[model samples]
Target: MDKEFKLASQLLTLLDTEQRWFTLAEIEKNLGLSDKTIRKMVEEINKQLPSTMTIEVSRGKGIFLQRDGRSRTVSEVISSMFRETIFYRLMNLLFTNVGRFSVEELAGAMFMSTSSLKKLIVQLNNNDLKPYKLRITYSTPMVKGDELNIRYFYWKLYGDAYEFTGWPFTKINFDFINQLITNIENEKKIVYFINSKRRLSFLVAIVLERVTKGKSVKITEGGYPWEKGAFHLPVKALAKVLEESFSIELLKSEIYFMQSLFSLSQYHYYEGSEMTPMKEVELHKDKEEYQMGNRLLTLLAKVYPNIDVKERFTLEIYEFFDKLLIDNAIPEWMTISKSNLTTYVQKECQQIYQEVQTCMQKWHTAYPSVLYNDFHLTKLTLLVRSSLRYKSKKAFLVIGEEFSIRHYIANLIKKEIGDQLIINTSIMKGLTDEMVQQHHIDFVISNFPVALKTVPVVIISTIPSKRDLDNIRKELLL
Candidate 1:
């Protein structure tokens, strides 16, 4: 056997007898090996060890062997190692599933020497993925060009946490597949994006068709598990998949945040869990005050250089911003004004005014524009008619500014509950107070003070804070 394997076996025997944690120095001295050898041995052993058996290194302490209680017997340990290796390998393969890699990186990741790993890689190319056996095309005379691109593609398509439980061994034909992906990019046939779920779903279906060949396909890491052959896998895998698929090109769109949030939410839902408060908070925090809004304002400034500063401007600009998020238009809006209201409409609007006008044309074709000169001056109570349009007896109305975070949260809740949700501006009307007292509203949410005593009220804003709510709650009780 190899000398390294022999030394590893001897070390394992000693550790079995010790039955306790051993310091690095102690292991080094016992084996009569240098620190480098010991470290290398540790890494090698980790790969060979069973999943049930973990080699842990404490912060100040040394290394110790702990039983996962699941790993027993040499075969079982070996199987676990292979499983983990397969998991990581599959993840890497999926990363390059988009296409681009060299045999060298694939060999290194599989922990096999170039020659041995190549054989295993041949199996990947020859052996079908079963139900869906994918045939990959490699560029001619592959030496080394941009295999990293393939790795990046897989990462974008899947995530780092992806696994190929369906396949054994980490060995994958990354070089050949990377070449295929590069071709796909050059062809510009594959439309990789987040918002156009319909288009993206179609593209994914096409990819699956080419690879799976009507075979049983499993997409682990956040996809619809019941999606016939596809499976909703994990979060980490999804993140990586998105990174590989979209690359830096996706950064140019305005709906980047929404697309990112959708991906992030999908990953969290699968890998983490639904209703994870911390994750939800983190998602919102990341989207807080994106520079896009300010950028829009800058563009607005250039187009309507001397537009009136009426609240009408704010409402008009807000409508334009709404379309930007909805349509996912990414232009040079980021470099425009990004400060506040003035910056958003006067500056950003000017830059993207043409794009906005173009989008408005399409929207107007589908639905007639609400003829209103002054959106702010319009009574909030009058908008209640729009809320009542939803086919629900009870409704939760959240009233706030367009930029208010509460508005987004309320929209989410409304979508989930399918309630007749009303979103009103900050201004109040005569009937607004009466509507509150009547409790006609299931929930009245306001970021500002209101005399309305209608159904229970919720004030959602950062300024007042929850502490302030306590006082308001008491006042309502009185």
Candidate 2:
């Protein structure tokens, strides 16, 4: 990732989220950027935005935005804030001056000296472009390696083109673009996520841009079993639209490129529907994704003995693994942070989180080449959360089987909780040792100490006091 974009994005986010004024010291504390750099970034941002959307400063109040209307959405603000950065301006130059352009011409367009332009290209080549084995063939300004990588780079760089709030590709027509997307979606019969539509449109823009540069992408081999049949109609329709729009026929490889991109796990999902939960995963008799999912899970069981979520959340796990296997975007696009998602999973599912770490270690032992990140952990935790949502706990209340008291305490517990807890009242006859073991009782809620060792026991008032119920609530979670 480019440092400039990162700095600008964080600055915009801090201002956007806080809304109220922030002193230079406060902003400096959060971002760790010097006051001079902050002022310069603010200046750069104001230059890109229209006059109506501006940041203002007061004598003692510090800095805040003065928007003409409602606060800008995060995406909208990011797109605009990064628009005139030296990085994107360079991007605009490279993508537009496709066929051939001189170093001087490019530098002039971006208002940069030729030497600075060279240094920037060198920086990009050594950092972001190095991993994909892609380079800016700068002598004549052409792309090297896979055209698909070039497209993905653009997706990460400026994001997809939007009517106003995003990167604007003036050459492409919105109506025509919509028609192509519609053709693909209608024939594929799969619904895209909310972000997919805009992203799909950008890929179309990518194709148009590359074709303008007399380039085409091809993925000749290693195609999945389900890709071709699923991709045919949409691919054909999109090809026709592009050809008609550009007055140029596409090479076969270009068509193959689109098909392969759609096949990537990032593009779509199984149509949203109710899938029945399972007690144990049944290996799919034919589906490859399901089979692969089960195989990984079988290996996972060796790492952690308690591996029920692998099967309990089979459909979710299957789709997740399938997507990760084919996802084409760089994992860098999704930052790995100490987020609420990860923290909640760690706090609520500590045992499972540890097991997942073990499973990941086992995976590395088997295949030492690939690296893992929090993106994988976050998704796994999401599956854990889904699996746990359907998990029902068994609880036995030892409140001395007095008819009135049991009924009253049961009613109170019912009002406090719900079907979440399956409660059975038992008399305080010193408790049965085998009962806890047989029924898989999560915890025993009793008024008197049961002196048990296997299952957790929480002592509570027979009358169900607020403090007692609170203690019971905390125990039930375990």
Model 1, position 258: C-alpha lDDT score: 24
lDDT per residue as tens, model 2, 189-266 = 556664666666777777887887777665544444434335756786688878986997777666766655565424
Provide the lDDT at 253 for model 2: 62
After superposing candidate 2 on the true structure, give the runs of residues whose Cα lies further than 4 Å from its correct spot.
Answer: 1-5, 15-26, 35-69, 160-167, 226-229, 244-252, 265-285, 296-313, 325-354, 360-377, 390-478
Model 2's C-alpha root-mean-square deviation from the true structure amounts to 8.5
Question: TM-score of predicted model 1?
Answer: 0.20
Candidate 1 accuracy as lDDT: 0.39
Top model number, TM-score: 2
Off by more than 4 A, model 1: 1-47, 50-119, 126-133, 138-247, 251-478
TM-score of each: 0.20, 0.66
Query: How big is the positional error of residue 11 in model 1, measured in Å on the Cα after superposition?
Result: 25
